[model samples]
Target: MKKNLLVFFCLISVQIIVSQIRNVDGSLGRIPRRGSDSIPDNEISVKLSGKTKYTDYKIISHKNDTTIIDTTLTIQKEYKFNFLRKDNFELLEFHNQGQTFTNLGYDFTNISPFPDIGFRAKMFNYFHIEDVNYYQVPTPTTEIMYRTGMEQGQVLDALFTTNFSKRFNVALAYKGIRSLGKYRRSLASTGNFRVSFRYETPKGQYTIKGHAANQDFFHQENGGLTPTALEAFINDDPNFNSNRARMDVNLSNAESTLDAKRLYFEHTFKLLSSKDSVTQKDFSNLKLGHSFTRDSKFFRFNQGAPTTGVFGEVITSSGIDDKTAYIAYNNELFLDFNSKYVLGKFRVKTMLSNYRYGYENLQNSTVGITKNKLKGNAVSLGADWNGRIGNFHINASGMLTPGSGRLSGNSFKGEAFYKKDSVFTIKSNVEISNRFPNFNFLLHQSSYDAYNWENNFVQEGTRTLGGSIASKWGDASIALTNISNYTYFDENSKPVQFSGDVNYLKLKVSKEFSVGKFALDNTVMYQKVANGDSVFRVPEIVTRNTLYYTDEWFKGNPLLVQIGTTFKYFTKYKANAYDPLLAEFRLQNETEIGYPTVDVFFNARVRRTRIYFKADNISSFVLKKNYFSAPNYPYRDFVIRFGLVWNWFI
Candidate 1:
């Protein structure tokens, strides 16, 4: 069966490549312009992943060119690929976007808003600045957006981009978020800033591109609600009422903070060039480039008193103070080729990196005062290929480290996608990777009982095969994954490595129906685990349904509004518990969590301003109050939130 699957994919890939070549003659090789003039004012080109070459792919807006205030806000369709929902800008949510404290699912990592840490948080997707999008704006462009949540939560974002000349451009972006949760000691705050520049010599022979960024994350840890408090709240105790602040928590005076800084620069000089008849400009055929990056991260956890009981006994003499720092420097040299014959691009690069990671526990006498450190150097080679034929696109990349350092490993990722002009699309992806355990999971020491671990673990290997199909009706996707030597925190909140292999299969489906101005959208996910349910736990079924009415109102249809109520539910299962000290979710068998949650929201747009009002947990009055997002962690209670986003151009 495996051999046949491989053969089938290979044959499909070959067919796609052949078809692309055969249709190349009739292809325009450029995205169609939407305006009457040669250059569309609403058209903007984008290049991601630090690619130096220009492509015809562009993001075009349909709004007319006018003052920023004249622009109208448009509702964004919710993503259907994931089962997560968006809660108010705060912590304690069941698999939600923007909110913290959720299951990792197939991510195979912890949930922390630190960019320097090996773990990835859902919020990181909102702060990632690696992808660069160049705009062809004739004038300066600036956008400012702000959103306010219930309690004291707020989010602000600002962006400015402009070109000094046809060959030089720069962009700056800033995002800030602060959320004071309804529960005590559950505040979360983050700030991210980035500045990037792209420059090209007048002759288009030499180019320089770079970006510098800083990110900071802060959150107060409230080690789950006490069992007594949870029971009282669930039974509708009058003393607690609906106020979460009165609920007793395990930890009342603890905070976690992370700070990170990054600088990346790449410069390329063309070795060969040819004139393009279509654009009347010189394009680089072969280029030599060098890239450099410096990244540093610091994490600190402070507690007013030593943590004890439940998790374990802490043998510490003083208050808890734990710190971890990581610094890495990377340099790479590469050669890039832009093929003129096959209409493809390829690049090969070699990189050298120096990484240093360490930690210090101030209150733990057993670990001493001296810091524990680990440092190493790694050398690796990587290559990437991207091409298009007809309406199909293919991208593939691979990297390997020849056992030169502790981080020695190999990874391969590839994807093929075909689109048939508003009809349907099909995409397939495969990935194989071998990666070392995260530094924190391998060696960590702290004054808290659940915060100390030391182990020499083997590298973890993973393979995933996925495919998706999308059309006007809906979309569906399936993924099959296998993991070997899986490392996770066990039921005891202790780091453990599973020696056996684990397999997972996931399926997602989304469908939409409309009647007049009313619409019903549903997303469902089903997951199956083989041989690892004890370690890897997930709800068997997760579903979200949204029913809403969208329409235009006011004179000249200037105001657009959408009122919707969302219902999310999951099957009962032994959900994993979270470790506040380690910022990781671990397997647990003592408690099972599964509940139905409902939220009502009203969103509107006026000109270039978008506004949102949401009432979460609206059905708490009727549903069982014993609901929990994770074991021992009571989900947020009923709450109302309001926010807005506004864009401006100058």
Candidate 2:
């Protein structure tokens, strides 16, 4: 099989090269130039720019962007998609995607505190207010994407954009997801909307970019299953066989919801410009800009029947209603300098910012209800630089808050990378920061007994050094980190600050091999604690493997298909427990969980449309039912799901 696959790969490579050579002398290889009166009827020339991270907004013929159609069709294409098969890009991580509620394998070195209203479970699905993109579409363009799950789960995403003139454009996008789990009290839903606009003067001396976004996330907290019920279900007790809803849960009538709204605008004017010889457009060498941002968040938790046994003793009524709200405002002024001074283009930005955050929380007590308000202000100076030297690129940025405020601290980050043609690349990064604890961790009050806390915790300081190498074969990376004054929830479910320093090391590697039409890909990660395993526990090893076959079907190769299976396993370890009232995973020594899981999938793409069909946990019938993603929380059962995504340009 291996020899056959290798020979097939070689043949395909040769065929592709020959096809490229043949097309080089034909009009098929030429990109249609702008301002052409006669454009290809089937071709669409697009310049996409908005969210710069996902896309660079470069002008390109639609036929050349294969990733938009190819990558989306495969489940094994990206590591993030394997963990959480959700449309919101939220990795189904055991830990690390957000905060450390549980001792899951999260890289604390990369965690940062953001001002939030305290609801966390669903925040992973919320679209970031700062990452909204502005679009420039020549004609009205619309894209609709829909997906269906095994249960009553569905996801719908829509986007529309149009240009009123060549100089101005506007876009609107909305995404909604609802997944009703087979387990009790495990329903999740999210709704997100964004509107953005971009405008530039005909002379290209002035420009404006702005966007507004709103997001809401709702979740039902089951507090996991009971130990007795789990054991019975694993033992194939006749009462609960194949009946998930019959299992006993810790909580049944609790819900957590969060809503956020944000508005941002930035305007820039060129102070100096030079004519670009190649593009024949004015290039701004020095630019002045001002930006304003306002963000508001609200969180609410309701329990129809508060169970004191599951969530500590409650000081409020049997039925509880708790709410928290926060608002933040930021103003910034910056100067940007961009030019080709030496070997490559150099860019630098220096900025001054003023920030304000205020919050109000409704606390319940035996006597009645109380409202608490807290506010803080900070002023910071920041700067960033990016430049290239030969085939290497470097970027560095830092910010310092000198005045007296809750956010008075300094952060520094730097990275450098070198690419050797297209064969391989090496990169290194370093980060040092002093950050305050989250507002909720500092002061929070709720109706549940274990959900209230108030303490003055010092700043947490972290330093990390990491490096990675990527080549045609695979990628490898390592990181070393040290943290001081770590804050976390203790075994007692109370917030505590660890004064001692903790050191950690993590290493990861991934590789892919292809033989003919068969491909095998594997990834493994190892984490070691030099000092603090009691506080920060993680599995020693985690591994994932995928084996697949790929081929083209039908005439003209219009259909590309891949059939594959994925296996993921992690070493058993003492995973942390979760606290529903706090919407947090806390330290626990009661149960340790780690298990192996398997999934099979078929993916195909036809032109601009992609289809996916998957059966997750296919080995559940043969494997032990003790498989748990977190303590007491059984992983999903064997289920089939199908979905499709389509992009249209009109």
Per-candidate TM-score against the hidden true structure:
0.83, 0.84
Candidate 1 Cα errors over 4 Å, as ranges: 1-99, 107-116, 119-126, 129-136, 276-282, 360-371
lDDT minimum window of 10 residues, candidate 2? 49-58
Given candidate 1, what's the lDDT at residue 142?
52
- Measured by TM-score, the strongest candidate is 2
Per-residue lDDT of candidate 1, residues 1-650 (tens digit): 23323333443454344334322245312222223235353543222111212122212221112222223432233221111113221123642223455552454222111113443332343344334344433334455555554367566666566566767777776666666767777776776777777788888788887778887877788877898987887798888875778889888888877788888888999999788887786656899999998988887878888767645677765677788888988899999888655568888999897788876434455644344777788888999888899899998888887773556788888999999999899999998888777777766777765566567777888888899999998999898889999888887767888979889888889888899999898888888897787787777888888898999987656678989888888888887676767667777777877788898888887755667777878888788777787776677677776666554322
Count of backbone clashes, every candidate in sequence: 1, 5
The TM-score, computed over Cα atoms with residue i paired to residue i, of candidate 2 is: 0.84
- Residue 303 Cα positional deviation in candidate 2, in Å, after optimal superposition: 0.9
Q: Which regions of candidate 2 deviate over 4 angstroms? A: 1-104, 107-115, 275-282, 342-371
Tens digits of lDDT, candidate 2, 270-378: 8988877977866668888888888888777889977888766787556888777778777778787776564333334333433333235456454233435657777
